[model samples]
Every structure is written in C-alpha cells, then in structure tokens.
Target: MATNFKIERRSAGGVRVLALDGYLDAHTAPLFESAIQEEAQAGNRRIAVDCTKLSYISSAGLGVFMSFIEELREAGGDIKLASIAPKVYQVFDVLGFPALFDMLETVEEAVAKFAEGPREG
Candidate 1:
C-alpha cells in the first residue's frame, strides 16, 4: 500500500510547527522539502516538526532535514522535533539527530524552547 503523507502547519509563538503524518519517502520528501523551503524563504526561522503520526521515513526524507538545519541555524534559527513516534525516532537516533537538533517530548515544549530564545552558542 502506498503511504499517504500529509503536512499541516501552524505558528507557535515565534516558531512554525509542521505536523507530519504517514510515510516520508523519496516520493514524499519533496513535499516536506517544499514546506521547509517555504518556511525558510518566508523568513520564518524557528521551526518544530511534530511526528506523532508519522509511520515511516526513507533516507531521502532524512536528507531533507540535513539539507536545511545549517542554513537555518546560521540565520539564528533552528528546527526542533517533537512528538516523534518511536519508529521514526529510531531512524533519527541512528543518524545522531538528537545531537544535531533539539528533540523535545511535545510540540508545546519545542515551541517553549523557542520562547526562551536560541541557546548560548
């Protein structure tokens, strides 16, 4: 069965929250990329991607995050992750995403971190 990927976005204080559902593979990666690109291009820096409903992700999907994190940080913004399903998290964990990004327990927590401003760097 083909997985259905969906992205719903909203603003949370100073951050943008993108809630993703279903599988994110090569076919769906472009959708995710476009959403992130839209956010970055529009100058909305702080972002949180909530993955509570996501079931699977391909390397291509992971690549999308890799492609954006740096430029976002250089702009003094970041991409946080929250509400990740364990399966999805395992993929991120294997890739050492926790070290490179903030993975919070909840979307609200991720957004709150932004409220606190960027960490001392």
Candidate 2:
C-alpha cells in the first residue's frame, strides 16, 4: 500500500512541534521534508517531531531528517524525535540517528530539552 502521511506543526512553550501521522516511506518522505522546510522558514528553530502516530518509516524518511539537521543546527535550532514507535526507533538505532536526532520518550521531554538550549557541539 502507498504510504499515507500528514504533518502538523505547532508551537508550545517556545518549541515548535511537528505531529507526524501515518506511514513515512519513499512516497511520503517528500511531504515530511516539506513540512520541515516550512517550519524552518517560519523561524521555528527548536523542533520536535511527534512520531507516536507514525506507523511506518523508511530510509527515505530518515534522509529528510538528515537533510535538515545541518540547516537547523546552523540556525541555532535542532530537530528532535519524540513518541517514536518501537519499530521506528529500531530503524533509527540501526542508523545511529536516534542519537543524532536527540530522540526522546515524550513530547514534554522534547520541549524541555529545547528550552535547555541547543546542543553544544
């Protein structure tokens, strides 16, 4: 089946949150990328993607994150992942992106992290 996905962005406690729901595969990866770009364009530096509702994701989806990481970081912002499903976490772990993206267990935690300041790298 074709991957059906939708992205929603919101701001809470000075953090931008992207609620991603549905499969994130080759077909839907571009949508996710676009959402990230839109958020960045809006001056949303700190970003968290809520993946609790995300069902599936592929390498292409992961690539979108990779593509945006540098830009976000350069903007004094970062991208974080929260509420990720186990399967998706496994994928991130395998690719070592979980560490790179600051994967968190909850949206609240992500928000707090964002408030803590950017990663010191």
Candidate 3:
C-alpha cells in the first residue's frame, strides 16, 4: 500500500463523506475499498467522495467504485464524487464515469445532491 494515501471520514447533511488524499493506485485501492465497505455494512447509503486532495488514480481505484455502485443503488443508496482535479477527472470522464455517477464541483454540492434524490443515470 502507498504510505502517502489517506482517507478521512466525516458526515454532512446525512451524507457520509470520505475525503481522499494522495495517490489512489492498486497498492492503495484496498484501503479505500475497505472504507466504502464499512460504510455500506453500516447502512450509510448516501456517500460523497471528496477528492479535493486526491493526487492520482488507477483502474484498480476505479474498480472499487464500480464494484459497490450497484449494491448501493439496489439498496437505495449512492456514491457521489466531488472536487476531483482536472487531471484525475479526465481519467474518470474517459471511462464514462460522468454518466454513471454524479460528479460535482464540491463536497457540499455532492451532499446536496443526495437531498435532491437518487441519481437518474
């Protein structure tokens, strides 16, 4: 696992916020996955991934999102991503994440989105 990667958990307006810092590559993806898993197991459905400090990502990191999305949505929950740097956003965009998930400009926006209801796409 990457020593620099970190995940900070918090809450905002009933949304669970996971703030990611540092690289999100194969070596560190498991840590992120476990965090999400814990939230799901705890029945916290509305999640906002605050990526303001995320410096990098890889397919392994992205896979973690894909793995849980369906299970969460099936249970009436969703994960929203926010504050991604342009460089990292490009990877997600190219993979069609923008359509599959709600990508917002800030963590606040992502939390607010949950209030508006579940995502359509």
Candidate 4:
C-alpha cells in the first residue's frame, strides 16, 4: 500500500467532496474505492473528487472510478472530478473520462454542477 496516499472527506452543500492527496495507484485504489463505497451506502449520491493535491494516478486508480460510476449514475448521483493537476488530468483525458464525467476546475464548480441537476449523456 502507498504510504503517501491520503483521502479527506468533507461536504460542499449537498455534495460530498473527497479530497485526494498523494499518489493513486494499485496499492492505494482500494482505499479510495472504500471511501466512495461508504458514501454511496449512506445514500449520498452527489460526489465530487477534489484532486487539487493528487499528484499521480494509475490505471488501477482509474478503475475504481469506473467501477462505481454507473451504479452512482443509476442511483441519481454522480462523481464529478475537480482541481486535477495537468499531469493527472492527462491520464483521465487519455482514457476518455472528460466525455463521461464532469471534470471541473474547482471543487466549488463540481458542487455547483449538482445543483444544475442530473447530468445527461
């Protein structure tokens, strides 16, 4: 497991904000996955991942997002990504996440998106 990874949970309006810090890879993906799982189980659907402090991400980390996106969407919730570093954004962009999820410039922007109503597409 990556000792450099950390996840901080908070709320922005009705949206749950998960602030990720450090590297997100195979060793750390499970921690992230579990956090989201707990949020979902609690009936909190509107989620925003604040990646401002996230320095890295691997395919495994990306997988954790994929694993829950559909379920969240189906339950009238969504995971919006925000404050991604340029390098980390590249990883998500390369995987076509830009089209599938809301990639915002700030955690506030992501939380605001939820107020606009459910995403389409």
lDDT of each: 0.90, 0.88, 0.95, 0.94
RMSD of 4: 0.9
Residues 16-106 of candidate 3 have per-residue lDDT tens digits of 9999999999899999999999999999989999999999999999999999999999999999999999999999989999989999999
lDDT of 2 at 120: 69
Q: Find the number of clashing residue pairs for candidate 2.
A: 0
| RMSD versus native structure for model 2 | 1.7
Error of 2 at 64 (Å): 0.6
User: For candidate 2, lDDT tens digit of each residue in 1-121?
Assistant: 4557888878888888999999898999988988888888988878988999999989999999999999999989999889998977889889888567788899999989987887865
TM-score computed on alpha carbons, candidate 4: 0.97
Instruction: List the candidate 1 regions with Cα displacement exceeding 4 Å.
Output: 1-3
TM-score of 1: 0.93
Could you tell me every candidate's TM-score relative to the true structure?
A: 0.93, 0.93, 0.97, 0.97
- Tens-digit lDDT track of model 4 for 37-100: 9999999989999999999999999999999999999999999999999999999999899999
Q: Which pairs clash (backbone N, Cα, C closer than 3 Å) in model 3? A: none
Error of 2 at 121 (Å): 3.9
